[model samples]
Target chain A: MAAIPEALAELVSDMESISDRNERAELLIETADRFGDFRVPASIASKPYPEDHRVKACESDAYVWAVDRPDGTLDFYFDVLNPQGLSAMAMSTILAETLNGQPLDSVAAVNSEIVFKLFGKDLSMGKGAGLMGIISVVQTEAKKRLAAR
Target chain B: MSVSITERGYVNPGVLVSTDWVAEHQQDANVRIIESNEDPLLYSAGHIAGAVQVDWTRDLNDQLRRDYLNKASFEALMSRIGVTHDTTIVLYGDKNNWWATYAFWVFQLFGHTNAKVMDGGRAKWEKEGRPLTREIPAYAPTAYTAPERDDASIRAFRDQVLKHVEAGGPLVDVRSPAEYTGEKLHMPEYPQEGAIRGGHIPGAKSVPWARAVNTEDGTFKPAEELKQIYEQEQGLDPNSELIAYCRIGERSSHTWFVLTYLLGFKNVKNYDGSWTEWGNLVGVPIEK
Candidate 1:
């Protein structure tokens, strides 16, 4: 059996044990990866899948890129799932900027470099986390640029 | 400690600064602009002068919750971004600023006082007619301040949720019809197993988080609109003790903001453990 990464192993374990009628069907995917073929109760199996932009961002590689609309003032998102990583990244970027007194743009670049290294692989492209990682770097850099002027 | 770039980046909410703000401050060289265009590689192809990409879920999510928001690993994350503490942050994103709001909440929890969410995010700024450039910007490094951990502001743990359940409190599941119905659950671990052997908490309700926002661009709906949605759709009362949860707590956080911030509900609490914890509990009773 392929071992789940330590970081993600606990997540895999927890997914297999969910007892929610509605959640079981969904956990089946995770279970199959870790546990094995199992019957999803007919009640949960029969339900329709949820339709959410974030879920789409997680499951597919269709990166709906967006540029600033019309005037091009700020950035635009292709879908509702664009800003998922914004706050988490911003918190640290802001702290780094304040603590080190380093220029925000520089920090943004550092972050970008890091994100690029982590998720830049072809297979990882366009996932929610991948896209968000990049956004954190860009947004941090953007803040640096804006603050200086 | 080594930290991933995503973990260390800033956690400010999305804000749409006008072109004038960008222009007037263009020469300042301190403000950084991030494109956050949903696609990092795409942003590399062409972005606002110096903008980079930011990951939404992975970077901003509460890793501890893995599915909720009770705790966050912010300090370890900051070191990776080279931010210590005391940084002023401006954040923005397109599509009504859902990502922006998420960031705003995170920063607030971490006690980053200087952070602000761009009003209207990218959509409003663009509509107002602002100039944009594809030139990448450069800059030096800066220091940042670490925030105080305040669990009260951001999350509620499993015990808290259990207490609420024990008290016969009502919980609001903020996922969509498919998610709530278990047809479209996000976490892959539970294969069709409802967290509880049955389904939802005995008296829980489904109030899709999207209902709190205007579908047009992802911005939250007006207070009146939210009130209407809660009353008509989920039977929520401002005076009741309410706990909101989603796959984890992002959507529920948005709902929390709306309920507490917009609707001015005093007794609302966010069930950070949400379905992820509740559904997985061993002996908890569930309803279908």
Candidate 2:
């Protein structure tokens, strides 16, 4: 199995250390607040994004974009159409922050279980699936890139 | 330019309040605005000013078992939220009030009938450019005493559902068509399989819950249109005993609210065990 990306592993470790639900929520809210920084720019994509890029089973209407970098790594961008989809935004922000510019093989190996680590075990089924769908899209992009190589 | 809740011709329009009503009542001591959401981060990010959050998983569900909080926990939750018996609880949340309605259903189990759902929920409120704040308000705890949960009236267990199926009673499958037809076992890319089996209970009418609401603003469709879908098109008798179910009953609660409050269905119940329990149970009938 491919090793988990270094940055993502560190984030999972950091998040897993926090025991308080409120504290974890605050941290995630803080991360969601940074969503604007990693949104898919107009140059990369725009409204009416292709349906193929849309994350299936995500009620939040999330879309993912991946741009290949010079060093054979990928830079990811995301847009969640639902303004109230804060969880999706947070997940997207985390993926962009940790997986961007990572080696393709390692990025493809990032497991969706990180969602439970970051959000805790109490996540509702629907919300958990939607957040994991975001991760799945990111992983799928990395795998597609690897196949092209 | 949608019709107002009262003008929508609902049988129980009083159960729904507009955003304007909420804005005026935010400071009303008798009214407590509660936001219940599927996403845990939304409440902390920002919410209607002075509104308290009731998380479905944490506050409403039992910690150890796959059940809701017991009487003592219910009273404690009410106390923490500073709600008295007479306080008019107004609920709203993200996902077009899916969690809000589920919260409403749970509150009903405790006989807290003095509650209203904010029409269109958080999406409508936000689209109208209402203000939201991150400051969580602190309220004095109230001495709340709740009755033991009465599950018989509006909740359906697996056995009851099987009986209903055997008796040819009406059931509404409020999940997506893919789930109803067993084309997909669960939502796409969802890691957990909802059930070992797929398809739906026998004799269930396929009525996706979203059909009851206008997708543009997430407000419920006018009662006439709703009647057309549930009564005329689906052939559901509003006066007959009916049960609604989804993957785990959250979405069905939305449909339950629609059938009971909006259309005044006389004998409607939410099969809370829903497809997750029914699909996996042995010897139960399933139809694609």
Model 1, position B38: C-alpha lDDT score? 41
The residue-by-residue lDDT of candidate 1 on B207-254, one tens digit each, is 877676554544455555667778666787877878888755556766
Query: Per-residue alpha-carbon lDDT of model 1 for A1-149, expressed as tens digits?
Result: 22322323343345335545224323322222321112123333322433321223332211221122233223312222223233222222222222233333333333322322222222122243433443443354446455656
Q: Candidate 2: where are CA atoms >4 Å away?
A: B187-193
Residue B67, model 2: lDDT of 85
Docking category for candidate 1? incorrect
- lDDT minimum window of 10 residues, candidate 1 chain B: B4-13
Residue range A67-138, candidate 2, lDDT tens digits: 999999999999999888888999999999999898899999998878999999878777788888899989
Query: Residue B56 in candidate 2 has what lDDT?
Result: 89
Residue-level error in angstroms, candidate 1, position B270? 3.2
- Show how many residue pairs clash in every candidate, following the order shown: 110, 0
